[model samples]
Target: MRAVVFAYHNVGVRCIQVLLARGVDIALVVTHQDNPAETIWFDSVAALCAEHGIAVTTPEDPASAELDQQVRAIAPDFIFSFYYRHMLPVGLLAHARVGAFNMHGSLLPKYRGRVPINWAVLHGEQVTGATLHEMLAKPDAGAIIAQTSVPILPDDTAFQVFGKVVVAAEQTLWNVLPEMLAGRIPRLPNDLSKGSYFGGRKAEDGRIDWQQPAQAIYNLHRAVAPPYPGAFTVLGATTYVIGAARMARRTFADLPAGLAVVDNSIFGVGNDGQAIAIRTLTANGNTVTPEQLQQALIDNPH
Candidate 1:
């Protein structure tokens, strides 16, 4: 069956690749230009599509008339959106002769908005799933077509969780695509009232608050830690990225919530009276050991 795919990021690329391997003809691929501001370590959907000789279009607007004409010309049997950046307008949603579905990073109804993986880690969710759902006018409010979950370990970084999600997304699509193409896909409504929606996170949002609980701070650290952006804290004029940390059993009662050096290791006292052992620290654009951070703090105690 011929399909029109709107995709970006690693998960998107993988989904497209799997479909191509299954011998599904891709009529058109709509993707986005890479963001120059962020460091990209994931596979590019555009590049992958080009390598397969699929027609790829990078559009700034999902609702543009030019894209409409292209979709109409192809008259695809299926339209799949995998981590595509923008919302598809109702006009395009109707273009699919068979079905239109979207693959989202989080389980249906929860973490509906952008960066669901990071938000799940930040919120300390023990389980999060990848969802493939019916594409509706409202973003991620679509009925669930298929879903598969992965566990979130206590110490799992957002990047690690993201890796699991990528795999989950691919498997979900693989399992459901046959039924979807046959017009036998099931629809389970996502109760909007029971779910939560979160906004997109920025680098500035990674700023850590020492006064929070130790576990909270640790969650923040792993939630935005590298390959995304490191959670940061400022001491004097120096800003340190909290690369790695663990919640300590003991709390320093006398120490105020901020920087605390104990036994040649760096710690941050939380307002909850607990301590977080700062394992690896990034200072002056370099990752350093705890002892090195101790020395830096002593040398520049401003």
Candidate 2:
């Protein structure tokens, strides 16, 4: 199956490798000309493409004249988008014989947007998954070809979930590519009513409001926690970045809500009418005990 693949980041390249190894003939690859995070390396894709001599383009827009010339020349049967950042234009879609497809990192009709895995964990959902669908002009609103769930255990992190989605995406591509390229792809329309959309979360969304339910606060923390911006709170003049934790009440007398019960976790009023706890935290270039933060409050009264 001849295809034009647009991708970004290491995960994108990994998925590309899986497709290529499965006998999909990749006509070209498109990504940012430069990467802000050094981690978004093309070494893997570059090496493979070099070995195979497949052309790569860093198109500002997939429909640009230069990009159009390349695609028109290759005339790929399909255009596979795996984490492509830009909203793909109709001009590009028209260039492919078999149409274009997207690999979304969520179970469609659920978390449908840029950061599905993060939003899923943040919303405290028990599970999420990967989906392969026909791309439409709208963001992530497309007919679904396949989906596979990844369980969201209590301890699961976005990073871990990201890994699961990667596995699901590669598997989905393998399972569906043959049918897709053959012009026999079987897909069902997404239930618009059933699907929900979420916007990208900012680093500020990590701010923990102590008044919120312990479970809700815990959910937000988990959603943005580590390998990410992480939850933070302005204590006096210092900004403390929160990490993982559970809900617990140490003592009614000494424990302060929204304060740490100990070195254990972030404190809150659980909906169950008990104290709450958060496990880890960092602040002012120092990782300290929750007690230290409390003492800071006692000393400075922020």
Candidate 3:
């Protein structure tokens, strides 16, 4: 069956490749333009479309009528969205003869909004998954077609969990494609009351609060660690990007909360009296040791 794909990034690229390999006719590809300033870890959807000689469009407003007309002209039997940034309008969703579906990074009914991976990590969820669901006007508030779980290890960062999500997404799609093409895919309605929604995060949101528990601070560190924005804490005038930390086995409540040199290692005291040993850190945009960081703070007191 012919399909119109609204996709982007690594997951999008993989989904498109799978469709093409299965002999599905890709009528058109709709994706986002890559930002040169942003850190990109995946193949661009536009680039992938170009390599296959397929028509591709990068429209900022997926809900616009201009995009609606474009997809309507294609008259696709199915519209598939994989990691597509914007919410598809009802107009566009209705244009497809069969149905429109999207692959969400988190299990449906939870972590439904933007940056699902980061949210899942921040909340200390042990198991998050990919959900294939019927596309709706609201963001990720869709009926589930199928889902596959991915484990979130205590040590896993957002980027690491993202890798697992990519695999789960692909596997979920592969398992449900045949039913989708046959218009027999099951739809399980979600209880909106039971689900939680999180908005998009910003670089400023990565600021760490030392008053939190060591595990919570560690969660914040991994949630926003590189590929997203690294979690940070200000020491003097310099903002230190915290990449990795561990919950110290011993409590150091006598020490004040926040950055401090303890036994030649950098540790952040938390509200729980436990310490988070800073394992990886950056200061002045350069990787620095605990001693070096403390020296920088000593040299530049604001």
Candidate 4:
């Protein structure tokens, strides 16, 4: 099948690989340029396209008239979007004579918006998956073609969960491509009423709230750690970023909600009277050892 692919990130790279392996003629690839301010940790769809000699474009606006003409010129049989940041306009979708499909990070009818993996981890979801669905005017509100689910361990970070979703996206597309190629497309119901939609998250969303339960606080940390923004909290006029944390196994008497240091381990006592062991902490972009945190606590005592 001849196709125009709008893709980005590792999921985009792998999904495109699947299409190529299936002998699809990728007439064009639409991708985004890596933002200098953001961390570029995943495989690049542009690089993959270059290796295969496919034409690629990094347009600031996917809906521009020029882009519309470009896509129309290709006259692709199908259109596929995988992890592409921007929404493809209906005008672009019309260029696909066969169909326009999208591979989403979460199961259809659940977590159906931006950064699905991170939202799932933030909400402490037990499971999340990838779904390949028909593209509609409304984002992620389309008929499901196939899906592949993965488990979310209690302590799994957003990055770890994203790795699983990438594989799931690849598998979901691989398993369903043959049926689509044979002109037998499946249209499973995507009950939007049964699921929730979430907007994109920001760095400020990582601010930890001490009044929350320990597990909730830990979930926040896991949801935005490292490659994503680390969860933070202000203490005594200083902002501390929590790089790693886990629910405290033991109890401590008379400890109130907030930062605490006992022996040499740093802890964040939640309003629920529970605590989380802060395994890695940082201040002003510098790592703060437990000893340093203890000394700070001693000097401040606030």
Candidate 5:
């Protein structure tokens, strides 16, 4: 198969590597144009492709005349969109005879927009899946070719889940390639009635609200937490940031929820009698102990 890989980030590199391993002859790589200090994992993939004498091109835009002309020249049989930053234009989507596909991190059409894994985790979903689908005009609203579920462990961060999903993605694509090439791939229409959309997250979205019930606020904790942005709260005026967290149960009924300290952990109590322990936190760029955390809260209480 003469394939075109549209990729960005670490997952994008894996997609290239996996396709290469499976003996799929890549026609060329279509990636986001690298910018100053922009560390998207395109370098290694570009280098690998170069070493193997496969073409690599960074399209200035998905619909650019130059890019369109280049792709037409390569005449790829299959197009795989993996973590590509730009939206694929309909003109490009229709280029490949075997069709273009995207690797989505959520079970669509439930979470149909960007960063679906984070949404799934924030909503406390125990199971989140990767969906491989046709690249339609709308994001993640295409017909499904295959999906494989990934576990959301209590200690799991977005980083961990993303890693798991990327690995799952490679396996799913390689397995589906043959059927897809032979024109035997089945596509199930996405139920638009059940789709939900989320926009790009902001810095303010990470601000933690202490007044909320611990469990209710658990999503806020992980939603903007790092390798993302990490949830934060303004203690008086100094913004205190929180990283890893878990919903913990307090056998003692008297303990107050969302409280700053108990047993060297900053905890918040929930209505249903559970305490959320926020471990691994940074305050004003300093790692602090539970006692220090209490002191910070007091000194900066807003």
Candidate 6:
């Protein structure tokens, strides 16, 4: 089988590996150049393609006439997108002789838009998974081909959950590629009404709202922790990024909804009188220990 792949990140790398392992002739790989402003943490699809001697292009726009012509010239039997940032145009998708499919970070039709893993964690979803589906004009509103569920533990960070989703994407593609190559495509309904769609998140969205419930605040912290931007709150003139936090066993009823030091441990007192123990906190890229934070709170008890 012949294919043109549009991919990026670890999921892209692993899914491409699956295609290569299954003996698919990858005619071209379309990927993005790493944004210099963003942290480049994931495996590169371009690097993997180079190692395998596959043709690669880093196009600014996948829907351009130039790219459309290029894919049409290849006349690939299939087109697969794994974690590619851009949505392929309908014209571009039509270039594939068989079909074009995409791998999404969450099961359809839930978490249908951007940053599914993070959104799942933020919403305290116990389970979120990878979904392979046909590419349509609307983003992630396609018919499901395959899905593999994975657990989302209570304290699982977005980065950790993303690891599981990447593995799930690999397994889903690996298990279904042979059948797809044999022209036995699966088309399960992706009911849009039954699902939710979220817009892309910004770093500012990680601003912690102490007025929320303790679990909600903790979920926000987990959702954007570490590799994703850490959830943050302002204390006087300084901004403190919450690197890690968990619900406290006890409430601090007397404390206002904000940061507090209770028995030497830094806690976030929520509006519901519940507390969240701040495990790792930072300010200006420097770790701020409980003692330091306590002193700061004491110095500025506004």
All candidates' lDDT scores? Answer: 0.87, 0.75, 0.87, 0.92, 0.76, 0.93
Off by over 4 Å in 6: none
For the record, the alpha-carbon RMSD of candidate 5 to the native fold, in angstroms, is 2.7
What lDDT does candidate 4 reach at residue 4?
94
Candidate 5 residue-wise lDDT, 177-228, digit = tens: 7788777988898887887888776778777665566766777676666767
TM-score of each: 0.94, 0.88, 0.95, 0.97, 0.88, 0.98
**Residue-level lDDT for 228 in candidate 3:** 78
Better candidate number, 3 or 6, judged by lDDT: 6
> Residue 68's C-alpha lDDT in candidate 6?
93
Q: Tens digit of lDDT per residue, candidate 3, span 92-171?
A: 89988988999999988998899999999999999999998988888888789999999999989999999999889989
**lDDT, residue 23, model 4:** 88
lDDT of 4 by residue, 138-187 (tens): 99998999999999999999999999999999999999999998899999
Candidate 4 residue 186 C-alpha distance from true site, Å? 0.4
After superposition, candidate 3 runs with Cα above 4 Å error: 296-302
Q: Could you tell me the lDDT of residue 62 within candidate 6?
A: 89
Over the full model, what C-alpha lDDT does candidate 6 score relative to the true structure? 0.93
* Prediction 3 TM-score vs. true: 0.95
Q: Model 2 segments beyond 4 Å from truth?
A: 33-53, 249-256, 263-276, 300-302
Deviation of model 3 at 204, angstroms: 0.5
